[model samples]
Target: MPFLKTAKLSAIAVAVVLSGCSFKEDRNDIVVPIIDAQPAQSSKLQFPQETQQKTKTVPTYSYTVRSGDTLGIIAQKYLGSSQRYTEILALNELKSSDAIYVGQKLQLPTKGLKQPDELQSSNSNKKSSDIEPNKTYPELNELVDSQQYNQAIQWILNQPELSNNVELQEQLVELALTQSKIYKRQQQVADAETLLSGLISEAPLTQNNQKALISELSTLKAEQELITAKRFADQSKFDESYDILLVAWQQVGQPLENNILFTTTRNKVSEHYHQKALRHYRSQELESALVYWKKILAVNPNDDLALVYQDRVKALQNKLENL
Candidate 1:
């Protein structure tokens, strides 16, 4: 009985050891599933991070057009180049450079656009070695005072140091205006127009200054037309004179309206045409008379004399055709 009881105790101890081994193997299977689950979660988290790292965005800006704002001026202010005006034009889908109006909004590309502080810093850097250290404003004034206009202009334009000098720019504009007047006095109309136009484009002029320059240029062109028309009239080329004056009257009538010289020349040319028309009318050349009458009416739609004569010549032409 004692031996049987000892054997039974040994058998129970072996059974307990086998069950403990099976429990350890089940725990390992559960832990492996948990470890594999961690790798799937890590991959999902890393994918979003990789996608976020790959994405990027560019920036853009908007600008409002102010009075005296030009594409060239805007480009120069923002892009550091007046030549980039074409880019502005393209961005805005503008067919004409003159299409922008005051208060109009424009989209500006931020790429390469310089901030005001950056532009100033660049100017400061440029001033260090690019300009003549000894050149001064007083010396420039001396050139203008001596009436060395060409040299003064060259100095103002060629000096990069004067790029940000507003006072010097104002002086350059005034000097250009004075020189243009001298050219006009010398009967150099083309030269005067060219000088004013060049200053308008090249110099950083204020709105009022630019407007004044444009007005002067228009007046110069009108005066040149008057001179040319009178020359043609003196040669008895009434057709050429009439055509030239007509174009001037149509295109630059506002500027010519206040010009005494233009008005006087226009009146003289009109009278010449009227007299030639009268000769043609007296000779019964109705077609030729009508041609001159129509030219007068084209220039001055309110010309009572031209209106009556045109009516009479047309009536006579109809009468002759009917007979």
Candidate 2:
């Protein structure tokens, strides 16, 4: 009986050891290694209001508006349908599709196309700088299609070999003009003037086509100046407005008298000067009135009204001097 009890105690000790080992193994099983969690790619680009559904993830692209960019054109190029312009309007909270302005940021739903980052990754298989001009053409074309005119121009200019390439140079001219137009539309007058002037200086001004483009750019620049001057004049900043108008009027390339934008702004500026002259005249400030009248005549030399006003003011000035 004593031998059996000792044996039983030994068995109990073995069982307890086994049970402890099992408990330790279970504790070990419960412990998980901590990993440094990586954020999902979509989260990086997502807006606060954007929610992903159970369907496959759709990529989005952000585009900046250039001149002549309409919602229909943007939607058709990026979303595969002009009818999807409503989607853009809705996404942007725009009252109308036409309300988009140059330089405005647009969130585009790239229905079948990859996002810009994904496109860059795929294009990374080949270094853009090492690619031949002919090979780089498609990428530049894609930039134009995306309304990324400035980027396209920079890419072309970065390629030293492309300087002598006539086709690429012509493309550069067009892209530069487009970018300048966008700048003008956005009221970035200095940027527009700088880009257009650079392009004009680079092109052979004697070449018919190059000359035509230069003239067009100059005319556009003048028109933008006129618009800007009129805006300033409307706010009663006559001196500032007159300075811009003087530059625009003396641009010397194209006669802007026939251009509608030019005509409108010119008329508005003239009216502002004429009104100022009348104000001085009413206050019996004949000399100040003559000065304003002469300012109007400086812009429009053939203005019958300004000529008559100047004559009348000068006569009043002479009479006041005599008195």
The top-ranked prediction according to lDDT is: 1
Query: CA lDDT of each candidate?
Result: 0.61, 0.58
Clashing pairs in 2: none
Query: Which candidate should be chosen as best, given TM-score against the real structure?
Result: 1
Candidate 1 — which pairs collide? none
What digit string (tens of lDDT, one per residue) describes model 1 on residues 1-323? 99986775444334435323211222113221100112222332232333323322445457766654556557667887654665665565543312345455566678889874423455556521132222467787677667778788778887775657766666666667677778877878788888888888887666776777777787677777787888887787877887887888776654565666655656666677777777776555567878887887566553434554565566555544444
Candidate 1 runs further than 4 Å off:
1-140, 158-170, 187-194, 206-208, 254-261, 272-323
Task: Please list the residue runs of candidate 2 whose C-alpha ends up more than 4 Å from where it truly belongs after superposition.
Answer: 1-199, 202-214, 252-254, 315-323
Worst 10 residues of 2 by lDDT: 30-39
> Candidate 2's C-alpha lDDT?
0.58
